[model samples]
Target chain A: MKNRVRYTFILPALILMTIIVAFPIIYNLYMSLHIWFVASGSGPHWNGLKNYIALLSDKRFWNSIRVTIIFTVGALGSEVLIGVLLALFFNRQFKGKDIIKTIFLFPIAATPVAVALIWGMMYNYDLGIINVLLKAIGLPPLLWLADPKWVIPALIITDAWQWTPLILLIVLSNLESLPTDPFESAKVDGANSLQVILYITLPMVKPAIIVAAMIRSIDAIKTFDLIYVMTQGGPDIASENLNLYIFNMGFSYFRMGMASTLAIVLFTIVMAVNVFLAVIRNRDVT
Target chain B: MSKSYIKTGLFYIGIAAITILPLIVFLWMFLTGLKTQMDNLAIPPKIIFSPTLQNFKSVFAQNNFLKYLFNSFIVAVFAVAISLLFGLPAAYAIARFKMHKIGLTLLIARMIPFISYLIPWFIIFRKLRLVDTYIALITTHLIITLPFIIWIMVNFFENVPISLEEAARIDGCSYFQVFVRILIPVVRNGIFTSSVLGFIFSWNQFLFSLILSGNRTMTVPVAVFKFISYEEINWGGLAAAATTITLPPLILTLFIQKHMIKGLTSGAVKG
Candidate 1:
């Protein structure tokens, strides 16, 4: 009776989950294997694995994949590095720490679309304050969005700005919870501050860092709003990561079939990465 | 002693700069929202000027942003309410039954790109004539809120002592009764945190509202996009819209900074 009740308790969420998430995934797969553009007002025509095969050779698809990798790595790498450093700096007892820490939480929770708009204005070539500040320092103004070379970096910078706080928060929390025995022992063993951090603190916080990195990487690869609002994958699709490309394929062009195929591919990549991270994380935990 | 004092002073300055760097952009945006178009674009940018309410007036009056704000509120609130109705029991079950697979499933749902669900949802919603309805917007917003609420509340439920519920069950109370009478009372803080975070996520959601919703149910984030066009950009209006959109989440984060941080970092710590 108790077991039955437990299963019953889970059933509602299961039903909603199936309807909201699982059903769409299956339907997304079904759409991917057919020609089902919504505007056509016709039923889907079955097309086996042809869509997947075609995506293999699609230059734009490959370009999006490449962009996703660069963007994810660039943003995730910098965020982890800078976040850890900031966490270290903030671990100390200091005046005004409470106020500064509270303020630091602002960007992590702010609306992404709004943040993107703010960044877009700040990156505008002629009217932006960034260029104004640059010229004040006797530097030439560069086009932030109009140039292909700068677009990915610009996006990465914005993402890092917003999310580095998350990494810092996680790391700082882990740092606070770390056992003090090792550090105390190390101090008595005549260890310097740098050596203690490298040997003792870093190892203790490795799991937190990895968790933070994986989370940031997943979120970074799926970034859409900031790109959609800031650049819309412009300058010849230079910053067209997989999410925006799939979005354009579905909504802008209404190529539902191709878009669904690409979305499935993106989903597979994300799930695979997630599974890999989970395996590693579980092993570390055990 | 003097050298160490100088070092501490330098560290404070560094921390202050690091803290302010990300926020300077937002500060600029807020200030720009209060400036006229000319003043916004003025060379060297205006350091000090008489702030104006013109941009806020234009966004609210011309863009029907207040309607969008209402739409956002409706979607976020209903979705979160529905999520709690469904998610609390599931989280309780998962926490008590060691249903790790179910938890993993919800995590995957949380991580799936919003686009993967978009095309199918758009098609289905269109077929049902649900497009542009708050029903469509609220249902899809559940995709974000449900998983988050379940995930956060699962951890919270785990921390609740099993003895309390066991005692309630032994007293001839039904499982549901125990859940309501004992678990809910004990986990009120968790429920509050989950609701606030869930509401914030739903309110800030962009992609679903962008693709699935139309003029009737546009959200604030999507509505702000109206200020930009191929022909011209309304910098002042856009900033004002952005500023307004950020206020609720900002204030929420400030009010519950500890819970928000703990909630956000829950997965990482337990990992």
Candidate 2:
């Protein structure tokens, strides 16, 4: 009876997870193996490994992979770099620190779709404040979202703006709880400020930095809403990452088979990245 | 010491400069939302302008902003509530019993890209004729909220000494009673933190609502997307709509900044 009751406690959550996550993942794999079209009256017919084979040769798929790499690296790299700098700065005692920290929390809380629209306005070619500020500073106005060359960078800037603060929060808190003994001893030994930071602080916070990096990387790979609202992978598909590519394939074009195939590929990439990070994290802990 | 104080002051100034620049973009959105159409498109960007509520007026009167806000609220509240209902016990069980498999499963659900679930959800909801209903949106949002609640709550549950529950059990408390009467009271703050985070996530959800919700049940984030479709894009109205969508979560963050940071970083430090 006791065991049955304990099982009941966990059963509801398990059922919901199975229905939502596990079932969909399995169904998606099944859909990827067949020719399924939303518009066609005919039901799906089995095609063994056909969709995957086609994806191997598709230029669009390759372009999306390339774009995903550029975006993931650009966005995650900057967020971590800037986040560490900000965290270091904030670690120092200062007046009104809490207020600034609170303000920094806003972007993470703001809705991404809304933030994207706000960015879309800021990047507007004709009447955008960005170009206006450029002109004021004696520089020529550059198309932000309009130019294909700049679209990916534009998305990266937006992502970095929102998420860099997350890394800041993580590292800042970690910095707070760090033991001060090493710093005190290093200071007693006549270590300079930069040397102390480079040798002492960096090593202490390395694990937190890595954890923050992996988390941000995972979330960054699945970016959709902001990209969807900002460019929709337009300007000749210059910014079409894998997530958006899968979305367009399934929803806009209604190619269920190809979309499912792309989704499975995306899933594998995400899982591999996660597993790679997990292994590193384990090594760090040990 | 005085030289170090000056250096610290400069550092604060620099931090403010870097942090405040991106915030200016948000400030500009709010300011532009109050500008007249011509004033919004003015050359050199209208830094000084008479603010007006006409944009907000139009966003509400011309567009159905309230309906979407209501829909988002309803979906978020119920999603958090249901997630807590199922997730709390599961978290407790995992924490007490070392149910590693269930815990890992929840983490996997959290880790996977949400896109993997979208297509199947679209098909299933459409077939059931449940598309655009609150029931459908709430059910779908559980995917985001459930795993989150379980994971965050697991940390808090582990923090509560098992000895407390053990003492309660010895005092003639049933497992359910020990959970309800003792454990829940102790973890009320965790519940609050997870609920707010879960609600914010659900409120900001765009993809599932984009595909699943129709005109009647569209959410604020998806509704804000409609302001830019193939027509004369209304800059003033779009800013107003965007601000409307942003303000709630922003306010929520301000009030719960401490808990929000704790909840967000709880998993990071341990990981």
- TM per candidate comes to 0.97, 0.97
Candidate 1: list runs displaced more than 4 Å.
Answer: B267-271
**Among all windows of ten consecutive residues in candidate 1 chain B, which has the lowest summed lDDT?**
B225-234
What are the C-alpha RMSDs, in order, of all predicted structures?
1.5, 1.5
User: What lDDT tens digits, residue by residue, belong to model 1 across residues B11-54?
Assistant: 98898889898678779889989999888767777889989999
Model 1, A1-286: lDDT tens digits are 8899898999999999999899999999999999777787888889988999999889999999999999998998999999998898899788898888788888988899888888887888987877788888999998988899998999898999999988998899889998889999999999999999899998889888888887787688899999988889998899999999999998888889989999988888887887787788778678
Model 2 misplaced regions, further than 4 Å: B1-5, B230-232, B267-271
For candidate 1, what is the DockQ-based docking class?
A: medium
State the lDDT of candidate 2 residue by residue for B1-271, as single tens digits.
9999898778877977977866897898899889989898787676789999999998898657799999999999999999999999989888877787777777677767787888888888878999999988998899999988888898899999989988998999999999999999999989988999999999999998999898999999888887678323678888888899989999888767887877875554444
Judged by DockQ, which candidate is best?
1
DockQ of 1: 0.76
TM-score of chain A of 1: 0.96
lDDT for model 2 comes to 0.87
Q: What C-alpha lDDT, on a 0 to 100 scale, does residue B222 get in candidate 1?
A: 83
